[model samples]
Target: MTANWTTYRELLLPGLTGRRAVESELRRAVRDGRLRPGTRLPSSRDLADQLGVARGTVTSAYTQLIGEGYLVAKRGSGTTVTAACSWPDTFERAPDPAQRWRFDLRPGLPALNAFPRDEWLQAQKVALLALSTDELGYPDPAGFPLLRAELADYLGRVRAVATRPSEVVVVNGAAEGISLMGRVLKAAGHTSVAVEEPSHFGAADMLTSHGLEVRPIPVDDKGIKVDVLSTTDCRAVLVTAAHQFPLGVVLHPERRHALLDWARAHDGVVIEDDYDAEHRYDRPAMGAMQALDPSRVIYQGSASKVLAPALRLGWLVLPPDLRDTIVERKRLDDLGTGTLHQAAFAQLLKTGGYDRHLRRTRQLYRARRDALLDELSRVLPDWTPIGVAAGLHVVVRLPAGVDDLAVQERLARRGVNAPALANYCRLPTFPGLVLGYAALTPDRLRHAVHELLEAL
Candidate 1:
């Protein structure tokens, strides 16, 4: 028999912060067995509306139970209460909802709901049936050769990147590719790398994590200032030429040419993270920066944004000179990606399923992006939204003197989740919100946006 899942609205309230009135009420709900194991809790959205408190409050309450072993998350399943979790006996300030707000507007994530599960499962079935006993053993350190060959054809058709399979190294993802390149470049006597100011904090963290000096060059409406690049004594620069993260501006043509020219002159390498060029809405897609200077750029692409981050699959089309070093580095890093998963992904790509998925998701994201913008115009007419032409997020610049962190906290009180742009920037800049629309449905997005307006 299937276990009957229970709803603990009352049991959850004693755990809530705002009501001194309901401490006993929540205890009663729990003691009466109203809440049961394997019962999925109401989503932050549903509970927020029910409790008349912010979603953050509900997130905090659930999180408290989860941390105490009251809840467990099963991948491909929902979060559920566990028999082992202990309900707290006393009250404290509501757990910080900032960390748990579910309708997160944070940038650089894809809509996980739209992943083509049926197609991928079908492809996996075919790959499994065709596989031999030998193929089930350890994967090639360079990756499945068929996968690499398919990547070569796919990249060429989509990105205009001219590369042979031999020049490509399959790393776990773009982060791995970047780390590998950092190591390879450092070995070749390049210790200093240049990054755009307000550049990807993740990339900067990676370089800094590897003991590399990252010089930050300012970015303008035209993209990263090449004039600053001319002055830096750096050996490599990581640029998001197709669509910059957070800011969402494409690298300017002049800057692209300048970067290529500079790399040629200084024997530098440009690492291009072209993670989502497939989702462009406002203009024609940009070609790979590596296309202009194949010898000087190491292009990195990933399935995280288009498919799902959990896939942990990405590829690097390196310059011929860096090929062997990058491969050697990847060999040391977990050997390679999962053979079963890679084989399944390869079959999906070869059968055109992946492309169709991207095409469908692209339209879905575009609609969501437009919906977010419409909500922004309605709710934040005075605030300026930057980087609306592409990508999963839109940047909403707050009204002058409006404290972003305070606004974020207030919104937390309203059960909506958004991160301040200040959190993403190293140097102080204008206060804003980086809102991701891909993962949210249209109705939920509108409600979240409404909460954001109420917070402001």
Candidate 2:
């Protein structure tokens, strides 16, 4: 007779075998709450058959578990999890409720669904095959040599970032890179750092958390107000120069020179967060501010937007004087990022695969951005879309007296997740929503925009 059995395929490990493994699996399941109290376990014979083990092994495991108070067995009844046992906390954090949305328009997220998996896998294989025992040992705190070299070349060619391989330090991501820079700046006795007014909220938080005083510098259609920044005594400033966040304005040519001049005159530093500079649609390419003065600027870039955030791979092109300290800081933080992944990324870059992937994805994103704008024009004609020329998201400015947070909450109830502009600002100034388009298809983008309009 066919017996009813719940699948326990995930519990099986290749190295483990026999009754001991079975007992361990059962114990873990009960302790972890995967098998709740009074939950019925499959019969020993059925479990044994499914696991390709002897029924005696399953029976022995069940007997041991029952004796240990994890399970109970009775005549004419099956083995079941016990109710009285307690387990130590594993300390796993709960998942974010915001991630449960059916349609998410949160800004700064790329098209994760379109990641080049097969190409990455092949590159990984090639990297692994080429690695020696020495290469697999402790990694360089700066980064993989090959990746640094390739990145130096690529950055120079693509973004006009002036740097050598030795100046590049591989970081976990832009977030970590910023934190490290903050710490280094604090250690150097810098007390205050100026940040753009409506900049990335996370960037401000990271700076604050690192014990630096955050000074907000207002941004306009021309980007960060350098004239106002010159008036402040902040020793350092963080900026998104290529494509300003939320407002989507490129740093004006005069402002770029003025920022560098301000840094040079005050001996201050510019932490250029080169976020989403690659996804430009309407504008000609802009060279990095670091290229103008590498000594006074810390240029940060990440694979998150172009490739995938899950990779957590980023790079910082530091000035020569700051390189040693930052490398030391990286050594203390996780002893450098994963070696294998770095090697694979280097291989991807070396093979020109990275460039090819970017070309394809950029075209797709441009199309998606166009669809989002077209739909917005039709459905929400009154809402002005800002920063639409580049990046994965656009900022939609609302009419006067419209509460963006209220609209966000209302959209959340309908399974659409969009962030309010006020959340990114220190003071309430702009009333809008930051809507991402790259993650969703054109059809879905149109439908989501329609739904948003209807909800409004």
Candidate 3:
């Protein structure tokens, strides 16, 4: 997840007081290795304003740190923690998780390098200027009306999600959306919820946390087994119908109808996690299952896959009857997502900037995916790539008798981090690795695949 500069500011600002205090904090941070080498200090003027100190005080602290060999400042480059600062041996410090790998092919990460910073900043500027004083106040716990409206319309057009502004309740991200669903469903007499057998482990943990038994229903090439689901007593099921996670399959059209029929017959609900609603390569991705039965499907969408996850933006298009309860749950959850972000995203949506971003990233991701597939065929001809060519990742089936877990370990030793497919499953499944291609260039992806070949 990406933290905005403002988030970093909030995290670093509290309890900072005088020049000495600032110096003390910086020294402690650097000494403990929390402030790792090469970390740039905030500008002196910005630090002064944020901390209510004189600009010269910040400059003094910088000078003191520099003189002591803790920091270095060049003419063009800002002040940075110097290599002279000792890496704390006694402290349990670590680098960013991705830094551990030479190539990060783990599933579900978007291309952070390709994030549209300029366009987002422009949207934020528009939002900030347009927001009325009243709009800046505590928002309706459900969401900002403008954002809800924008999300409703955007989802309708892009994913064919059936919704209205009143039905959309903005949450922090899909994680929170799932948590809210778990809480609400469990409270409303739902004892168990069915999830795809090979599904997001974090979501299962969330459901378990809320006292709901998460049943792992088997998924086939056609998607989740609705026939099997019909026999179960679970009243709600979470699905990635648009582009099934990890596997990247779309829910088959007949099965889609059958699942909704099951919902109608059994008084069940579907939590449609449209995690990768767009980003399809070969063709237009299927519309969300939420469109088939709005009363039964709770649609979940987020910017995590399209934008940087650090943005922490997601929404739920709720059933009319469930809207009030979910919105009330959101009220108690965090009063609502931050208004500034919501407003900025609204501006992005309203101005068509979001669509432009999608168009650009779709092409980039498609090219990267092509490079990976082509390399796999050339170098590892025996490996089978499964599912549609429509997501950030592709699952490659290993030759029979190969242990994917062992392969993953070997890849880890080689500084690559492709996840074993079996780890995502509750039941036994085929041996394979889930490779994410979005974050890496075509050349890097090819290099990673060669490394995989070596590991094999």
Candidate 2's residue-wise lDDT over 343-377, tens digit each?
99999999989989888888898999899889889
TM-score of each: 0.78, 0.80, 0.80
**Taking the tens digit of each residue's C-alpha lDDT, what string does model 1 give over 1-456?**
132212444445524544222323433444355656555655554666666665444444543344334444443354565554344556322333333454666677788778888998898899888788998987777788888999999999998998998887777888888888777777788878888767666777778778789888777777888888989899789888887767778888989999888888987888888978888887788789888878988889999989988888999998877787777777777777678888898899899998899889878988988888788788779878887377788888888888675566555444455766755565768888778889888887888887886665
Q: Which stretches of candidate 1 lie over 4 Å from their true place?
A: 1-99
Sort the predicted structures by lDDT, highest score first: 3, 2, 1
Off by over 4 Å in 2: 1-89, 92-99
Count of clashing residue pairs in every prediction = 3, 0, 1
Q: Report the lDDT tens digits of candidate 3 across residue range 15-71.
A: 566666787777777887777787877766666777776654566576556645576
Please give the range of 10 consecutive residues that has the lowest summed lDDT in model 2: 91-100
RMSD of each: 10.6, 14.7, 13.4
Full ranking by TM-score: 3, 2, 1
Q: After superposition, which runs of candidate 3 have C-alpha atoms over 4 Å from their true positions?
A: 1-94
Clashing pairs in 1: 55-415, 70-85, 105-436
With candidate 2 superimposed using the best TM-score fit, by how many Å does residue 40's alpha carbon deviate from the native?
A: 33
